[model samples]
Target: MEWYDKKTYIEVYPPKEFSFYECIAFLSRSSQEVLHQIKDGSIYKLLKIEDSLVLCRIRYEENAIKVDFPDRQPEKEGCSLVAKFIWEWFDLEADLKEFYQLASNDGILKGIAKSYSGLRIMCIPDLFEALVWAVLGQQINLTFAYTLKKRFVERFGESLMFAGETYWVFPTYEKIASLQVDDLRELQFTVRKAEYIIGIAEEMVSGNLSKEKLLQKRDFNEVKKSLVSIRGIGDWTANYVMMKCLHDTSSLPIADVGLHNALKNILGLERKPSIEEIKEYAANWSGWEAYATFYLWRSLYDEAI
Candidate 1:
């Protein structure tokens, strides 16, 4: 994870292409975000590690991401897990040189790559969170999606009180596996979304699906097929999960409205571009489709409200 425990806090050194500011900006895009809180250029999040709650204050310091414990620091083992989580969350292992090279030649991405050079594909790290979040966002505006998420988390997720503030972690699959559709519907989640999330949680509880098993498939199509094999998970959901959870660089969610809007802004079009045209413009993105799309999403900071 490229980090070490400095006794007081853990220091994580990310790749040169990573910008803590850019990532924190993305995280802070939603004022309704309950998972993390951004304050004074640092992000505060409550994480569950080895069944314990760890409150972390993450900020950039001397070219490295410093994780300090505002509540309490766990043992060395917990520190390592937090470091690994940070690595995956920021996608530090990814080499963006090739993606930048590809973006330079594409008209749609050329300026974006340069404008947001150090931005990485901030990931969900947890497969269940990624899947359920994608489901919650389906066919909803970004602001409303975040509202649903906040309501869902505040209702079912665990929280820790630290210095007069409550920090939360995403509700575990085990917690949601026992829930019924009506339980989630009370939080304003659609019937289909509630079913989809509960079903996914049940699958996890039954040991039928997992991030490990999905990645074991290796091939992109195989992974997509496995995800789509689950009811309510379609092509867009599969691609979104692959990119955010599995770290699949080639995963492209072409139907994303934010991507279309970014293209409209960059290409100076009066209307949204056709799906076929998006495919053609994105042809060069090939292996870097996920990165390209993420960069485009960043172009519209209000994409998530």
Candidate 2:
């Protein structure tokens, strides 16, 4: 991520193929989103950099992402952290050329990839957020998933009121680590999910699970295995975390409902694909399964799975 600190703000330059519009379309899909607010085509997010809670106004302009702090700037290191956050949030480091080339001849992704050429995987930079989201979305529809997320964030997250609306920061594991299962269940979380969330937070607090640790195990299989070893994370969730949080390009959630629906619609199948069928279709995807799944998910909607 190439960036420059301009005293009051920092500017990030993305690759030529990066499409801010497409990412915005995906971000705008859920009106219930609380962690970030999109208004007037600019995204406002609250991030806690070390000790300072920084509010940044992010917009793509002139092929660079302009991040402006509404109140005041932080230390130089904080500026770089914010830039890195934005970089990972957009998954800007990925070379899409390889993925595009692989999709060009595929039976499933050729057209879908072209249709959403510039759309990057809207990644969740926080490991906890990504893992919790996967849990919340299990066996639920996207709208309800967003509903759950909004409720959860509003209940436990921090916020700052700007203009008229509020900008939220996702709840910190440090905060949630002190919570009990009953607390989350009161917010409409299932008992299982509440336990999983609390347990995951506790694991992080105990230094048992951290994104840094996962990144150290660069082997895709090793990372996936480590994630799946966690009580709440299954193969689907592990693959999801790998793709969204660890930035593993080969991770694929073949059982994802959105992927199945997208494939059914794209292939004109009367019914959704079986697990075996999806594997057969995905065989050639190899190292680009994450991108392929993302583009296919885009075909279902601008929802940005």
Candidate 3:
């Protein structure tokens, strides 16, 4: 991998309340350059995939914002978009004052924010792609999911070379939508995953799954219900995709195995919580269930460390 250095300055349209360091940490979790080592409270490890190591940090001073990615210099046109990406990922502009007030009134929100800082529920704004990835990851180890995604991206995604290295874009629905199930299976996807991806693609291409329309609804539960109505998407997959990709703050994957295990361990329960138990436990989270899940996941890894 090749490495480049760049500095970016962004104007914060609305003043943000979260710590700059926390924002960087949250953004880094979503960056392809950093692999979040959850075994230890979500410490980021720079993976030397090809040859480059990317590290990012942020500095906030009154009206000006400074973002530094030491190892990779961003292309000129991408700078503004990158800044927006970080801001959106951290939800830096969200009105946190209201949430804080609510947290003071509710013990669960206070405990959750104090413990994990609302670091989860960062959505990538690409619902179709996120849904496909979530379905591919179901009931399987994350390593395998990454491997499959890598292959899929390399095969179907467009590539751009910057600073003497190559980066691939996530495959577009139009591209993957054209692929046959056999083509996906050749890339090591299971029959179920292939079918699910194809189904999602068909829906997207046929205009049944409209990202614009989904965002317009603004009701998390309604979007989730719509997603699960698709043939291959279940509860876990729907909630996970909505939380991560749609940035649905209210969505929670109560049936997720990792979440269940993490909650059991953190709350000192004897065994993993059942889906019903998890739902009841998370009820207090209300509008912040996705953040609650993030805290539980952090606690899970932190406990191991």
TM-score on alpha carbons, each prediction = 0.95, 0.94, 0.75
Worst 10 residues of 2 by lDDT: 1-10
lDDT of 2 at 125: 94
Residue pairs with colliding backbones in model 2 are: none
RMSD values, in order shown: 3.2, 3.5, 6.0
**Poorly placed runs, candidate 2 (over 4 Å):** 1-7, 302-305
lDDT of 2 by residue, 1-305 (tens): 22334357789999876889889888887788878888788898899899768889899888899998875687999999999999999999999989889999997899988877888999999999999999999887878888988888888888877557677888889899999889988888899989988989989999989999988884988888888888889999999988998888899998898899889888999999999999998899988899999888778774345
**Tens-place lDDT digits, model 1, residues 27-68:** 877789999999888888899999999999898999999998
**Which sections of candidate 3 miss by over 4 Å?**
1-9, 13-15, 23-84, 98-112, 118-120
Candidate 2: clashing residue pairs, number = 0
Off by over 4 Å in 1: 1-7, 302-305
Best by lDDT: 1
lDDT ranking, best first: 1, 2, 3
Which candidate order results from sorting by TM-score in descending order?
1, 2, 3
Q: Is candidate 1 or candidate 3 better by TM-score?
A: 1
Candidate 2: residue 17 lDDT (0-100): 68
